[model samples]
Target: MTPRNLLAAGLFCGLAVACANPQAELAAHEHYETTGGSMKLALIPPAEQDDDGRYLNLDPEGSHGSIATRLGFFGRRILTPFRAGAGAAEHTTEAQVSIEAADSVQWVGHSTLLVSMHGLHFLTDPIWSNTPSPTPPFGPSRFVPPGLALQDLPYIDFILVSHNHYDHLDVPTLKKLAKQFPDTPFVVPKDNAALLNKHGVNNTIELNWGEQTQIGNLTISCLPAQHWSKRGIGDTRQALWSSWSVTSPNKRFYFGGDSAYFSGYKLIGDALGPFDLVALPIGAYSPRDMMQGSHMNPEEAIKAALDLRATRVLPIHYGTFDLSDEPLDEPLARFETALQTMTNNLSALILKIGERHAF
Candidate 1:
């Protein structure tokens, strides 16, 4: 079958499975109705929650997108020829191993990153699968392979997941990591533990906004992000989504899971400014009316970096999977253009899929 046909077939199968699960659909609708104004959620500060226990975005008005609108976008997108761009120029395994002692960041494709700092290694929002979907061939296929093979990674002290999005929280990759490094902690936002547990990944530390945990010398904090969550038909917003902050004694780093432009960045900067480095998403933002509440465009990402008061900025969430309407290379192109016009001396860290940069 052609690629388009395969995608259509896979989507049909997935829909069929979802339809077969009547209880899940009913639960979803029930949750939505009960959530009415406030919601029931956990691991969050009371201030961030509603009277009924549902989690709320910093922007009360924030929304993922209308279902009809998204369906329209998907319909239009599927009809067009899929264009998998020339993949990123990945580096070698030896290069990855060489970054052990020095503080470094390696882009492993999409939001997957290998960050080593202060004697410990960290993997952020890891997804090594060719497709970021439970139902394969139905979702966007990875245009390039990961920068470093899973076996090439140094000892990972912590695996941080920012949200429940398929691209950020891939089960296959997490399962492999669980097997490879059984002792490492899998940190995630509140209410996400069950999913990992269901997949046999029992070593998880879940947190909510304003919550944190310590591993070795590092302090990992779960912060807010303007985004929504949904892994199945009716699981929308049932789990918390967040950005993350990892701080050692001398250096600090921020990994933005996925978020739209919001005033919360300024709040975060005021509370935890002067981050040494920040990784922000610069893709999957188009049809502004629909995406403005979820993903940030390139310029907004740059502004987020400045808001975080980051000394160095790394662009991510692009050039791997075709998740939105923008051209694959457009994010970086616009990022570079925005950087050239910046008044601050914020350094830009650009890397190929497998390339590593030491700080």
Candidate 2:
């Protein structure tokens, strides 16, 4: 189906497939909701629970994983090579990343990127643990190390965390960063301040969609994305999910933390257009029926980039961990295929896990 068709179908099915949430359950937090009570959801008017325009509507009746599917994903992981070695070979060093420009980006690993703009160094969804899970060294092992070690970073002015997911918001890393950079600000979604505080990480600023804050010379606006937030049970949807637009004096940039394909991209672009560069996720989309709601495949990522009117793109969220059944390289392969089919020449900057690009 065309992207538009898929979106329409999604709205139809997604609206019908409602997740349950009693008012009492969300009494404490007005910003939280959930669909089918699985992944917590938030409603943004004009793009709220009813706004089907660009929402990814996975079928309510689609094939959801049973015990068998869970086992199957595990089996596939064990059997598939998933480019574990090639990703390991791409490890970048701090020396290589020191070649800086006024604006530059380095793909540290999955969903973790170092964006240097406005004369300030910022990291998006920073995670340097050996895995995406809380119990690092015990969960998915990290074959690819970060391009720049925590110590290697020149100095982080602030950190932008998309959600509370382990991959995106590693509290251990946060604690370390907080201890090391005592003055660095940690920007996150609402209701997430306590989480950081628990790790002894202070200076956190929480934002809701449409809220903007000034950090140094740049203006950072917290925008919505089609996604959910949770570190464990009962905390789902308590914290908001978001995309961010960081506008500097001369350049505007975007960081798509983690999300499924949604119309918010167009809305974001409409509201904040012509991004000099956008860091978008492009992996973990196998079993589309299940992941469609929160994860975007390569094609979907491509569409998202176009929707955001992004001038250049850096694809992340793959090659770090084998989160899904698809091969690690499959996203790029599919991205190539989808890009070829596009009539408009799109400038997608594909970087090695540890590589750097100056914009």
Candidate 3:
């Protein structure tokens, strides 16, 4: 098939799927349904989930335009937009970070983040790829390189994967990490084991929504997110998607792997929250109508932080990749405006790429 046709929305589809009655789909997939149009899909053996032929969300939405129309609009835009000092790395430190640090966060560009608390290190949706797609020379290109190279990383105890999107779950980067860490644990969502297995990853743990696992002093909780997943054609929702909570005796951290505005933040906070820091996405939200179902805008992100009762907020998933119509710096500008409207005592740590935010 031509590349344009290949750009079809895996999650958003034509009337055959997208237009299916939400109530009917929700009714059919009752087990996955939860409050506020979110899902808690069972992350079982890949075969079990695939055996059903497809995964369904309780309340789903697709953009009004077809795949071709959206593709053409995006194609006209260059790989990276014109932004002054778009990818400057002046403040980055390549110093080997230790898990023993009391608390620190290293933004490795885009949504890739390395966080440390009470001497344990965890990374979220780590990606070091030049492009956010399987097809190279197409798709969104990176505006900046990763803050720390794979080799520069300190000993990583756990890797937290949110979903299987190319940007969030780059297989090429995963292969390098698996080779380097060998036994480091990879905690992924369901339906993604086969890919990691093929990549020679031996220590992979898959979890469903609401499940929790312990690694050292960290309590890793797999939680629900308002998002969809599809790495390729015919695989929409074949894998589960999630956000995560990493809690230590001294502090709690929440990484919003990828999500739009939804009530789940409050639910997550209620279950296990009042976090020290929240790493939430505030980019790729232009043409808001097209991205609303899957991505959060700056204002919504602030509201989510409030809902979660996070004391300190770190804005991520912006300024690294030109994924939408918004300017490279627009997310930050909007974040400032949104923060002012909020009536709460909080802090926004808008770090430059490769900069460290100490706790």
Candidate 4:
């Protein structure tokens, strides 16, 4: 099927599922009752027009024209069935395997990182799928294949999930990892535990903003993010979204799962200041009028880095999928330009799909 038709069908199917599943409705209500705060059921908001005479306050426009426009530009350059050949493998570095006092951080592509510090191993937003869609057959497929397969990862002690977006919280990848490492613990936002639990991920814990949990010596705090969550149309705001602050003895890492520019950054910085490293999103922002409230542009990301007081920033959420209108390399180029002004304060790092950085 054409990309347009596929998107249309997917939207239709998603809406259908959202409407038919009474369990989902009940689950959403129960979730809200359990954790009372500003609640959003799905990531995308209901279609609405802003005072600026544009459709800025709405869920993503999941239409044939929208899909075709993005695909027509990006489809030719990005690969499908995303298999990294020998050349891609040749660049892969053998990350320090020991879970203790390791010096390296491996990029498994997208937001997934294999981080080893203070004698522990952790995976963040692990997406091993060709596409970030709800279904494997269609959606925004990866532009570059994953550097390492699921089986290739070291024994992961903890899996950190930021939210329930398909790209960040993939069911298939989580299921495979669960089977491979049954004892691995999953740390996610409070409302999102059900997503993991539904997949038989029993060893999971949910936390609210400022709530911290420990696995071994690693202490992970669920921090607030100015973002939304939803897997399908009707289920909007059913889950909570967050960024994570992971602290080890020797190093501290801030993983910005996905967020827009918001005042929360200052709060995070005040609470967990002087982060050693930060992983922040720098992509999927287009037509700023529409995306600015949810996704951050490169300049905004740089500001977030500054606010977080991170020593170094690693840019993720780009170079992996064609999720927005900007060119594949636009984010990095813009980030580079933005860094020029800050001189000493702003430094950014891009992890070549499978590349590893020793921190």
As for lDDT, the candidate ahead, 1 or 2, is 1
User: What TM-score would each prediction reach against the true structure?
Assistant: 0.84, 0.79, 0.81, 0.76
Clashing pairs in 1: 39-52, 39-53, 39-54, 40-52, 40-53, 40-54, 41-53, 147-354
Model 2 lDDT tens row, 141-201:
4667777778877677778998777778887788888887777788887677899988788
> Which candidate leads the pack in TM-score?
1
Worst 10 residues of 4 by lDDT: 19-28
lDDT of model 3 at position 213? 71
Tens digit of per-residue lDDT, candidate 1, span 20-75: 11111101111112123332223223226566556779876554457776666666
- The digit string of per-residue lDDT tens for model 4 on 1-359 reads 66775664355222211111111111111222223444322222222334532322123432223455434434432333343221221225455344343556778887888887665678999989876766555556566778887777777778899878778888888999899888777888766777788889877887766666766666777777776666775666566678888787788899998878777787678767789889999886774544566778898999999999988899888777656556667887888888887558756666776777767
How do the candidates rank by TM-score, highest first?
1, 3, 2, 4
Candidate 3 lDDT, 1-359, residue by residue in tens: 36564453222222011110111110111223333333332331111233565554333554535666555545543323343446332346555445364588888898899887766666888888886665555556576878878897777777899888778888888888888776578888766777888878767888777666777756777777877777656777788888888887888899998788877788777767689999999987766666777789999999999888999888888887656677778888888888888746778888777877676
> Which parts of model 1 have CA positions greater than 4 angstroms off?
1-47, 51-53, 63-68, 77-81, 86-97
User: Which residue pairs come into collision in candidate 3?
Assistant: none
- Cα displacement (angstroms), candidate 1, residue 236, comes to 0.8
TM-score of candidate 3 relative to the true fold? 0.81
